[model samples]
Target: MSLYRVFDIAGTGMSAQSVRLNTTASNVANADSVSSSVETTYRARHPVFAAELSKAAAHQESAGVRVVGIVESEKPLTPEYAPNHPMADDNGFIYKSNVNVIEEMTNMVSANRSYQTNVRVADMAKQMLNQTLRLGQS
Candidate 1:
């Protein structure tokens, strides 16, 4: 595979990780949100990733990562009895978001590391290209 292809693959990976980080941030932001009903409650959102196999094959014959979609978590919401709360339902039960703080934090850390790795990969590719050009000049 060409050196430039390395940049392309790494760039795609960085983009996917950016999306994942964004979704994880959103999930964390809404973790404490409460609603009167399940329909109105905030569900933990996650980014779905898929392999860009064809493009990867065209570039280096390897699989590359891609963000497929952002999906809401299916876990049941937490119900709490808050009779005086404004958003409480008829049964005085408020539905809280299903987002787990620890999980979101872990995801954030992972996405951050993945993004950093991609950046390093792209930087290395750039250095290699520069070296190749220098060799041609010599």
Candidate 2:
């Protein structure tokens, strides 16, 4: 693989991490949200990642990460019997979001670490490129 391919791979990784972080934040923010119906209740979302193998193969390079889609959690919503709640249904049941704060926090940390790693990789590549340019100048 070429030195520049490092940048492409790391850039894609960073982009995917960004999406992960955004979705994690969204999930955390809606963790406590409640609604009258399941459809209106916020569902925990996660980004689906896949390897960009075809692109990498076409370029004669190894696969890089890509976010295929964002998927909502399939976990059942928590039902709270809060008759006084504004969003409570006729049965006095309010549907709380399935988002788990702890899970979201963990996901946030993972995404942050991945992002930092990608940043470091990109920075290293840039430094190496700069060093090579300096050698040519000298």
Candidate lDDT scores, in order, read: 0.90, 0.91
| Model 1 lDDT, full chain set | 0.90
State in Å the error of residue 42, model 1: 0.3
| Model 2 poorest 10 in a row by lDDT | 55-64
Q: Give the runs in model 1 whose Cα sits over 4 Å from its true position.
A: 55-63
Please give, for residues 49-116, the per-residue lDDT of candidate 2 as tens digits: 99887977787875689888999899999999999998899999999999989988989999999999
Best of the candidates, lDDT: 2
TM-score of 1: 0.93
Candidate 1 per-residue C-alpha lDDT over 5-121 given as tens digits, one digit per residue, 9 for 90 to 100: 788789889999999999999999999999999899999998898877887657656467878788889999999999999989999999999999999999999999999999999
